[model samples]
Each structure stands twice: as structure tokens, then as C-alpha cells.
Target chain A: MSPRLYVDFVRRLGNMTLQVRLAIDTEILVLFGPSGAGKTQTLQAIAGLATPDSGLISLDDTIFFQRVPGKPVINLPARRRRIGYVFQQYALFPHMNALENVAFPLAGRRDARERAMELLERMHLAYLAHRMPHELSGGQQQRVAIARALATEPRVLLFDESFSALDRPIRERLHEEIRALQAEHRLIVVYVTHNLDDAFAVGHRLAVIRDGRIEQIGRIDDVFIRPANQRVLDILGIPNAIRARVVEVGPSGALLDWDGVALEAPLLNAPPGAQVMAYIRPEDIRLIYPDRPLSRIVGTNHLDATVVERRMGRHVHRLRVALPDGRQIEAVYPASSYATMSLAPGERVRLALRKESIVVIAVHSDPPPIEEEPRLDRAKCADGCPKSDPAPVSPSPS
Target chain B: MNWPAFWLSLQVTAVASVIILVIGLACALLLVRVHFPLKILVETAIMLPLVLPPSVIGYYLLLAFGRGSPLFEWFNLRILFTWQAAVAASVVVGLPLMVQSSRAALANVDPVLENAARTLGASEVRIFWRITLPLARRGILAGMILGSARALGEFGATLMITGNIPGRTQTLPVAIYDAVQAQRYADAHLMVLVMTALAFAGLLLARQLEPPTPGRRADQSAKASV
Candidate 1:
């Protein structure tokens, strides 16, 4: 079957230019970006609320917008596009009660009232049906807006940061509710959000947008685990991006030289003597105390490090460890293991860097010097270790 | 008391208010939401009557609708000294109030709500009628009331175009002029008192219809919940 929606457009507003091309099927595609990244603009173009300067937007077989140079343009009005959009502010009709607002689009239909009531019932908002928008709470108003959007039975639904206004608990509940509704109705949903947690919780696929361009689009896991570039990695908040030099390239993998220590990472396209940024999540690094014997995990790189800081998380303790070669890395330890080990600042530990978890981001020659401090400074340091220089590197075994 | 003049003024005001309401709403909607070339010029023209002297407007109306003008030459019709001329003068005088208030009201209606309505499959007409019009009802009503009050008290324009014919076209304001000229102080005082009461009532109603202050609305909603 054809994709549910396809959009390729280029629009210029003032000095900012928004260019995007995307196709979505019957799944929730979350447009993830910071504010002013053109996420909301994309939704507007698809719903026909904002016109694009050039390009085509099609839903299934119906073309909603098409404009080519020296050709007749076809731009359908928003009313005829049959796309439902829930605004960030809810946009419920203040002049109408909840029921009347939901029934508004259903006007001229035979059973608009009954259908509107049914939708309210499904939203569990029947009790507030007679209440005006101001009388309803934020969450209730959002539900009413959703019901109103669905009243027309649109081909696709667009949500522009709809849950950002609610508290955490309410937002989560609404996310789950919307997810269930999308699945039940088999809707083509495009949700926009700047919050990573919201995107992960609601999106089947993720599209990372920056500066009006979609940098990457893929399954949530793939985008999170194997980002498209260093920018994507940084946006995803993947910890432990270390600068390294490619010293040896073998068929199996490449050996990266960080300071004086050699680490093995998945083979990349870079030749020998090329600079690359290696990324690994802090949770993927396994911590072993100096007193305990290291596990016999194969194809793993191990380094002796001293804990400079430890931060207590909800379920894990984040430790900022300094390698013997002066390189700093972060690792997360389970609360149970941290309690059992009784680890503290100035304590020595062994860190196992999993080979499969290492991602090499290619870099051109003449990379900028690395900053000594790790990005996450939440961990309070107990030891008086020099912030600029954690340790001095000794001669390598090689 | 000139009952015929009072009745004539009421009829003229009633007809003028209806005409002003329709045209004013259309102009306000266009000014607030639609973009076009020379928009500022059109807005300025609509507001010209508000700042111009009433005698100036009356002079223009006399030149346009008087005998031998287009109304007489092209249509072979003469409205001078007629109640229809009085109605025309009232409509022109009252229009600025209607257009200004309605424009402000329509501008205040959130564009997001209209866009939301559009995405929900509402046609432009339906969105205007069902969403924009209802949301701006208070301001529109205030505009109509103010415009009607303005039409009722219109004297210079009415006298210039319709002439001061007691039973045929003399309105309350014109009748008051005639009474004062005739040294009928008691009759002039009664007419002034009645006009004052009506204008005062309209102003009070418009004030009541104004959207509640933001803080007051918040407090009202809070108290409503309690």
C-alpha cells in the first residue's frame, strides 16, 4: 500500500528557510527538535494551514498541494484537506461549551450531536460536556480539542506539542491515551515535541530536525543507538564522546589511540592516522572494583580508573572516573551494586568498555582540542582532583 | 413634543443601524484578517467620518444625493428632503462606530481558533459564521448599539440632506434645533433630556458588553469554580 502521507516542500520566511521531505505510514512519527526548528511548520504545511513556496504534498492518492515553476499550482484549502490538527494551546472554542465545540465541525450532519456526545463519552469527558472551555482544566480542554479534531474523521492527525502544557503525570497519561487511540483507529499521526522523553514515549519513529532541516529519521532505537552524525549524537544526549586517533585498521575493527591507551572500536571508513569521535553511552560501561576479579567478557576493552565523583540517581549511581592516561569517562552503576561495593571518591576501579556499544563518528583532520571536564557536572566531586588535568599519562605498553 | 419627529428619528436610526451592522462587519473582517494592497488607505477612508466635522459630511452628502446629482440624472430619482435621505445620512454618520468597534473585536478573536476550525473541515464561511462571529458577538453588539445611538442624534447631516420638514423628515435632533430657534425652551429641554437618556443607555450597555478585564475574568473563573 502507498504511504499515508508524503510531503516535499521548501518555504522561506524572512532569513530562515524551511526545507523538508518526509513520508509517513500508519504509525506515529514524532518530529523531535528544539524550538524554532521547523517542526511545527512542517505540521502546518501538511495540514494546509501554511502554504509552501514550492513542492508537493500528497495524502495517499489525493494531492493537497503542488507547485512547480511555470506550471499551474494546486493548493487545496485547509477545509478540503481533511486533516485534523490539535494545537499546542488546545484552541478549544471559548464561546462554545465542550459538547458544542466538538459538534462544531459536525454541523449539517444528521447525527452530529449524537456523534459528538459519543466522542465526549469516549474521551471520558461527558461530565464536562456542558462546561465552557474556561471551566475545564487544561487536560480536559485538551481532550475536548482532540475529540473536536476527530469529529470530522480526518485522514491524518497532526499534534503540535499538544502535551507540553500539562504536568508530567497528566502528560504521560495523555500520551498513553493518544497512543492507544492511534493504534485503535490506525491513524497516520505526526506528533511534534522538543522533549526527548515525550518523543521516546509516544513515537514509533523519530525524526530529528535542526535549523529547518530533518537531520535523521528512523526507528527510535536505531536513531538513539546509531545516530546519523555527531550532531544527532549530541542532540540525543549520548554520553562519553571521546576524541581518538585511528592508529590501526583491521578487517574486524580499528584500534583507536586515546592519549596513550589503545581502544578497539567497530571498524569505520577512516584510514589510519585519521581523527574520529568515539561515542559510548555511560550505562553501557561496566564498572568493576579493584578488589574484585574482572569478568571474562571477550572482545572488551578494560581500563583502570579512579573515581573522582559519584552521583546518586533514581536507580543508578553515575560515577565520573579518570583513566590512568588522564582521559575521563562516565559510567553508571546499579544502586544495588554501588551499595554492595561501597565505592567512594579516590577509589580505584576497572571499567569495561563493551566493543559492540562503541560508535565511531568520522572527523576531518585538525580536530579541535577536547575539553577536560565532562559535560555532566551533576556529580559532586569529593576528591580534590584537578579539574583541568585528572592524571598524567604513563608510557603505553606498546 | 414633536411625536412625528421622534418617530421619524427612530425609524431612521433603526434602518441605519441594520445597514451599518452588515457593512461594518464585512469591512471589519476584511481589515482584521485579509491582506490586500492599499489596505491602510481603505481603513483611513472608512474612519474619515469619525474625525471630519459633521457639517463636512453633510456637505458631501448634499452634493452627492442632492437634485441633479447621479441619483437624479442616472436613476431619475430624487431623495433630497425625504426620510430615505435622512436614513442615508444616519448610516454614513453611524458607520465609523460600527466599523471601528467590530474591527477591534474581530481582531481580538484568536486566529488559532479559526485555524483549528479550518483543519477540522470547516469552510471559510462556516468558520466566520460559527466561530468568528459568535466569538466576537459582544463587540459586534456594542458596535451596533453605539452606531444606533449615533444615528439617532445625527442633526447636521440630516438637516443638510433631508431638510427640517416637521412630519416628513424632521428628526429629534432637528426638531430640538427648531424648538430652540422658536424660543420653545421647555420642548427643547424635553428633547435634549430624551436624547441624553438614550445615548447614555447605549454607552452604558456598550461598556457592559466590553470583554471583561483579564484579571477580572481570572477571578470570575476562580469564583465560579468555588
Candidate 2:
């Protein structure tokens, strides 16, 4: 089946050049990225609000923008695109009340009021039909904006961080509402958000954008489990990455020498003597007190470490452990587990690195350095420690 | 009281204000929305009458519409020293006020709302009529009132172009000048009082019609609706 939306565009905006290509089916495709990553620019190009320097954007065979190297370009105006867009600010007409704003797109058609009322009802805002934009709260205004967009029954829906302006409770509620609406209508949605939780909550698939380029695109679980590169892993907040040298290769797996410690990981596609980076999720690392019997630790990949710090998170306790070789790794344990184990700083512990959970990624040649160090309070591990340390161990796949 | 001059001034001001409103609104919309080469030049030209002396503007108007000029030679229309000349002078002098306020009001409107309207299938014309025009109505109305007040008090330009022809082209301010020259102190006082009262009323009306300040708009709306 043909994809619902196909977009390939290159546009120069000020000092940045936005170049993106995407094909989306009828699902919520969340364009996830930091600010100024061109997610909104891509949406504007599809909605016909901004023109691309050169490229084609088509929705279900209808070309919204098309320009070849030597051919005449066909660019449809925004009014003709039949795409619904909810602006980041909600952008409801201040002069019009709720009902009138929703009815605006349906003007010159029959049953405009009835249809508008139906949409307002669907949004649970019928009682506010007569309230002006200023009279309504932020969430209510956003709901009206959504109702207005739906009044046109557009072919595609584009939301540019529509919930970023609302409170958390309201934002969460709207996320569920929009998700249900997408499922019920089978609508193609391209949602742009900088918040990772928002992306995970509303997106069936996530597209990681950076510097006007799509770094990776996949199902949420796939992208979270196996990020495309270090950038993707960093953006996803994965905490544990260790640089290791391949010491030996076997049919089943490869043995890696991490700081002179022999570690066995799942087989990766690399030469036996090549350097690679191994990534491990903090939650996957099992921690045991030294009092526990060594026989209970079945894995050969275990490390004796001393807890350097303990940070309490909303749902988990983060333990920063310094390895025998002075390398630091982060581990996450549920609050209950940390409480039951009575873990504290300065205590010795055994960390079991699960072989299956190790992801080996080939180190690219001098990958671009992260511009801003990830915030320590939010970072799961000292994953960024490699940047400060010399002889950076390249993380490899398991 | 120079009742004829009083009636004529009112007529001239009303006609000039209506003309200024239409032209000023169109110019303001273009100035606020469209971008083109020499845009700053066009804006500076629109504002020239506001800074130039009234007699200078009248002198230029006289050269353009005077006898033997293109207007009279081509169209065989005699405008100088007539009521039409007075109206023309008033329009020229009042245009800047109309355009300035209207442009400011249009510029203050949220452009995102207009873009939203476009994506919602609104044609450009419909979006302006339904969204932009209504939102900017307060400022445009103030512009019209200010324009009218400026037109009513026009003297030097009217006197230069129309020559203060008594009972014919003399506006209130021109009549006041004529009364003072004739040493008719009572007549001058009456005309001055009437002009002052009318100008004051126009200014007061404009002030009342001005849109609420940005921070106060929500509070004002809540109070008004309640």
C-alpha cells in the first residue's frame, strides 16, 4: 500500500539548511527533536506554509510541492492543501467565540453550525461554544483549535508541539484524546515535540531529528532499544556506554577487553582486534551485595564496584558505581529494591552485565562531540564520562 | 457665527475623512502585510504630509490642481478656490494620521491566527474580512476619528488652495482667521469655541474606541462579559 504522506525537501533558512525525507503511513509519526531541529520546518513545508528550496512533497498522490533541478515547480497554496494544522500557540481567532471559530472552516457549506457543534461535543467543549478565546483556559482554547482544524476534515493533520503550552495533567489528557481520535479516524498525524515523554506517549513511530536531518526513524520500542548511533542513544538518555577493545571473536560471541577486564558480549559484526563501544541500559544491570554467594551470579561478565553516589529519582534510585579500574557506571533500581537491599554510598557491590543487553556499535571516525553535556540530574549514568576521559572507549554492539 | 462656513467645514471634514479611511485602510494593509523593494521609501512618502508644513503641502497641491496644470488642462476642471480644493487639502493633511494608526493596529494582530485561517481553507480575502479586519477594527476606527479631527481644523492648506472664500470654501479654522483679520472678535470667539469643542469630542471618541492594552484585554473582556 502506498504511504499516506511522502515528503522530501531541502530548504535554506537563515544559517541552517533543512534537509529531510520521510514516508509515513496512517499512524502517529512523532517528529522528535530538540528546538531548532527543523521538525516544525518540515511540517510547514508539508502544510504549504513554507516552500522548500527544491524537493517534492506529496500526500496520497496529490503533490503539495514539486520542484526538480530543471523542471517547472508546482507549489500549491496553503488554502488548497486540505491539511489541518494546530499551531503551537493554539492560534484561535480572538474575535470569534468557540462555536464560530470551529465553524469558520466550514463557512459557505451546509450544516456548518451543526457540524461545528458536533466537533465541539467531541472535544467535550460544547458548553464553551459561546466563550471567546481569552475567556477560556489554555487547554480549552487548544481543544477549540483542534475542533476548528477537524471541521475541515483535512487529509493530513500536523501538530507543532500543540500541548507544550498546557499543564502536565491537561497535556496528558489531550495526548490520550488525540491518540484516540487518530485511531478512530485512521488519520495520518505528524506530531512535532521536543519532550521525549510526549513523543513516546503519542507516537506510534518516532523520528529523531537533529541539525535539520533525521538521525533515525523506527517504532518507539525499536528506537529506544537499539538507537541508530551515539547521537540517538544520547538523545534517548541511555546512561551506560563503555569503550572496549575486541580481544577475541567466537561463533557465539566476542570477548572484549574493557580496561584490562575480560568481558564477554553477544557477537557483533567487527574484526577481532577492532575497537567498539558497548552500550548497556542502566536498568538491565543487576546489582548484588558482596554478602551474596558468588554462585548466585551466573554471568561471567561481573564487576566488583564501590558505590560512589546515590541519587533519588521520582520512581527509581540511581547508584553511581566506580569500577575497580576507576571507571564509573550507573545502575537503576526500583525504590523498593533499593530500600529492601539497604544500599548506600561507599558500599561494595557486584554488578552483573547481562550479555544479551550489551549493544555493540562500531565507532565512527571522530563522531561530532556533543555540544552540551547532558544534565547530570536527568542523565541515567555517567554515560557522558567518556567525553571527559582520555582514550575514549568506543561503544560497540552486543 | 459664520454658519455657512461652519456647515462647509463639517461637509469638507466628513467627505475628506471618508476618502482617507478607504485609501488609508488599503495602504495600511499593504504596508503591514506585503514586502517589496522600496517599501521603506513608500512608507516615508506616505508620512511626508505629517512632517511637511501645511503651506508647503498646499503649495504642492496648488501646483498639481491649479489652473493651467494637468488637472485643469486635461480634465478642464477648475478646483482652486473651490470647496473641492478645500476638501483635497484636508484629505492630504489628514491622510498620515489615518494611515499611521491603521498600520499600527494591523501590525498588532497575531499573524499566527491568519495562518491558521489559511490552513483552515479560508481564502485570502475571507481571512482579511473575517479575521484581520475585525480584530483591527478598534485601531482603524480611531484612525478615522483622528483623521476627521485633523480635517476639521485644517487652515493653512485650505487657505492656500481655496483662498478662504467666505460662505463657499472657508472652513471653521479659515473663518476664524478671517474673523480675526476683520477684528470681529465675537465671531472669531464663536468659531474658535466650536472648533475646539468638535476637536475635543473627536479625540475623546477615538480614545474610548481604542483597543484595550495587551495586558488588560483579558481582564477587560472578563469584566465586560460579566
Candidate 3:
């Protein structure tokens, strides 16, 4: 059986409380969340850098931390935990050369040089071994940090927004490198990032955190395609999350009244008259030319929409289209398609919301308004309609 | 010049700076790294010498190590009015500068870097020697310069505890006072020149011992990499 790390802890972080519970085996799990959402704190607790008020953290049989009320606390020091951590800034020893930094953990060994050289070579940093941290570029420094972290051959590795500092090209390359390293070492990796793209690119599983709580955790596809609640949908950065009401339910799926425009969704667990939220990926919503044949339509749910706005992106075109009820839905199409269609604002178009792709999330009673609603509305719509997505979104899944 | 006083002053300054460096570094590490109750009070006490009058420090030292004190009675240790007392006085007046400068240097070192070392399986002691010490070397050397200068010129405190005894307890500053009081103008002038020359040489030597600034090396490598 693969070794698993179990963490269940609560901590008070200066006017906020952090509570997290999760289990991770030998796989890459990305703690995805916004800034200050307690993702880093969770990693610190596991690494024994930050002690929790009460809880248990163990890897396989070795207990790293355990605090039961009215009982002895078993808290291990950070050095004894043997957990590798790659800090956000890399934090390479500025005084040491790349080789010395990688060899730090093996300080008293007879063959520390050879072992350090092997690790540096594995990171493709052998030629730059003598270079100091600030002398190297950001990407090089990050590689040295990783090599140093892995020098002890730790059971688990944690990265705290480690890749968020690199350029896209370098980041993508390192993502592939890290995945390869994980497979070779069979190390359980936990990466924290606020970027959806980085999370998807590097993670096998996704755990979305909000306000120090784990909002959702599952396989990447499971969590992204079938979020557990409306809160999960919001944290997932889905722009077209619409509050809808279930009008009918059947074995196939649920018929949802999305702002009076009826739409079909995959199998839902909610009953009729229950309020729910429908999330649709911009790429999943296809733009149908006005004169296209009826038999050529791809989805069951069709709605007439007027293009309210069109924004050009690098590889895709974002279009905000309005339904008959004045609610806006943002959709994206490949730039190649946009070159041919050249759809403009105020142009009437037909939109097909793929039933299989629409994630219907059950809404909690007295739900708080989404955080970006006010800013999103003030940016696009002047009438105070709650619309999401002022920030640039991920490119369409190609 | 009083050759005996010159030799005695050199010995005292050297001994005192060495002790100051060790104790000041320990105190600095405690202030920067460890957490305990009454930490602020401890820091304030360490810094007392920086603000207190030299005579006041001499009074406290007398109470602790003078005749009839516990140290003198129980251990039969007689430190008062000896060259060791001069060394002790120099250390007391020079320690605050060393601690203050070293604390600033150590505090400037990023805690994140130390945490990174801890995760890499390094003990606290190893992290200090390998990571913290090397990074803060320049600032610490600067502190040494300040401390040694203060020790070399220490007069008020040295006079209070170890009275001016030529060829025994009198340091160069006290030697100069003796020369001027006896109206030996030429002798005082020569000794003052020697004092100024020694201070300047010490400053130059510290600068020479320091490694090249990382900023310059980094800039060169950055260009090379580009």
C-alpha cells in the first residue's frame, strides 16, 4: 500500500481561524485558492514550521504532530519532520554557490560533493554549480531550491507558490520537469498556488481552499467538472455561474429554469423548485452562426443571445452575450474561429450550452454574494447586475 | 612613549575584543532567534551600557567583583586594580556597540532562508554557521571595528575600576593623560599620532578581511548570463 499523510488541524492566524483536514498519498495535489486563503498555512503545519492549536498530522506511522485536549502533545521539530519545502521566493542561500546550497543537507557526509553534484546534474544545473543565487536567473534559482529540497530524499515535498514567479514558458517547462521528478521519486507533492492555470498544469488532484477551509477536494476532473457547491464553483473561477431554479427532474438530467430561459443539465441530486447555480465553461458554450442548419446543432439547450461585448485575447476571443432576460454569459471561441466569424457587438447569435458540460451546483440557503460581483458589475454593466470576470481568464482548453 | 603602557594597552584591547565578540554574538543570536518571557527586558538590560555613564558601569562592576564581594570572598579572585580589571572595564563599555551592530546584521538576514535550511535537515547550530553567519559577515565585521575602536580608547571606565598605574593598568589614553599632566608635550603629541594611526590601520584591516560584496559579484554574473 502506498504511504499516505493525514492532516487534520486548527490554528488561529491573527483574527482568522484556519481549519483543514485532508489525506494525500504519492500523488501531486495542488492547494488551489486565492491569496491568504490558508493554503500556505496548511503546508506549514504539515512541515512542522507552524504548530496547530489542536490536531493530528502523521505520515504513514510516524506522527509529526498530535495535540489532544488534556493529553500530552507530540510535536516534532521542523528539522526532524524530514519534509522538503520549496519557498515562494526559492530562498536559496545567498552566500553559498549553487553546489554548496544543494549540499547543505549533507553537511557532514564523506561524499557530499558527489551526491550534491548528482542532484545538481539531475536538475540540469551542473554547469552553473558555482554560480551564486542572485547571480542566476529566477528559473535557475528555483531549480537549485528544488535540488536542495530533494537532497535529503524526504518522503513529502511542499511548494509554496513556487512557480508563480516564473515566466509562462519557463513555468511550463518546470511543470513537466516536476511531474517527471515526482514519478521517479514517488514523493507525495503538495503545491500551493492562486493561479488556475498553474494548478491545472501541475496537479493530479485539486483542493480549492477558501477562508482557511477546504471548499472541495477530488480528482481534477471530478472537482472541476462537478463542484460540490456554489461556493466551489465561484472559487473555481467559472465566469458564467448563473443562479437557476430546477423546473423538472428525470433519469437523464435536470431541466433548469436559468433566469426564465430553460436549459438542460446533467444528472442533478436536487429536487424541483430548489435553487441551484449553473456553471458553464466559456469554451464549452459554442457560438452557432445564425443560418446554420438545425440538424448541425451540438447541444440540447439553445438560447438566442445578443453579443453585448467582444474582447480579443491572445489565443481566444471572449464574448459577453446577453440572454433575453438581461443576464450576461461570457463565452470564448478559438482565435481561428473568430478570424472567420468576426462576430461584433450587438450582433444576434445563437448559443449552445452543452448539457454534459454545465455543472449544476446546489445553492446553500442565504448565500453570500460572490466577492467579484460588485467589481465585475462596475466594470462591465452599469445597471448593477451581478456579473463575474473582470480578470483575464484561462485560455480555452485546446 | 611609555613602551610598557603601549604594550599593555594592545594586550588589553585584544583580549577584551575577543571576549566581546563571543559574548555579543551569543546575545545577538538570542535576541534575533529565540523567544522567551521578558525578552524585551533582557534586550533593554543588554543595551544599558550604551546609555549609562561609564562611571555608573564601573560602580556596578565594583559591586560585583570588588573586595568583600561574593566573587572576591568565595573564589578568592582578586580582579580589582589589576590589568584584568582594565580588560573587564573595556569589555563592559565595548559590548553594547558589538551587540547592537550584530543584532542589526543578524536581524537583516531573512528568516525565510533559515526556515528553508531547517526543512533541509540542518540543525539550528549548523544553520547559524553555514547560512546566518556567512550572510551577516560584513555587518559583523563592521561591529568588530566599532567594538575594537571603543576598547582601544576606553578611558573613563578603565580609570574608575583600574586606576592609572603606569606599566600595569594604564592604557594608551591614560598614558596620554599622564604625559599631559606631567607637561611632557612632545611625548603626548607622539602618542596621539600613534593612536590615530592605529585606529586608521584597524579600519583598513577589517575592510581587507571582508569578502567582496555580493551585489557586485551578482551584477557581473548577471551580465555574463545575459
Best by DockQ: 3
**DockQ for each numbered candidate:** 0.27, 0.28, 0.29
> Could you tell me every candidate's TM-score relative to the true structure?
0.75, 0.76, 0.75
Candidate 3, residues B1-226, lDDT tens digits: the string is 8888899999999999999999989899899889999999999998888788888988998888987899999998798899999899888888887888778778777777888898998888888888789877776777777788788988888888887888888889889988999999999999999999998887786666444533222222111110
Q: Second chain only: TM-score per model?
A: 0.91, 0.91, 0.86
Better of 1 and 2 by lDDT: 2
- What stretches of model 2 exceed 4 Å from their correct place? A240-303, A306-398, B211-226
Question: Can you write out model 3's per-residue Cα lDDT over A1-398, one digit (the tens) per residue?
Answer: 88899999999988679999999988889999887788888998999888999999999999999998886899999999999999887788888899999999988899999999999999999999999887899999999999999999998999888877799779878887888898899889999888876775678778999889999998764576578998887888787766778788899987988766888887666667766655676777776655656443355788888989999988678899988778888887777673556578888888877775476543322333453211111111112112232433333322
DockQ-based CAPRI category assigned to the predicted complex of candidate 3: acceptable
TM-score of chain A of each: 0.65, 0.65, 0.67
- Candidate 2 vs candidate 3: the TM-score winner is 2
Per-candidate RMSD vs. true structure?
Answer: 12.9, 12.0, 11.7
Winning model by TM-score? 2
In model 3, the runs with Cα more than 4 Å from the true position are A69-72, A241-303, A306-398, B201-226
Candidate 1 stretches greater than 4 Å from native:
A69-72, A237-398, B213-226
Query: TM-score of candidate 1 restricted to chain B?
Result: 0.91
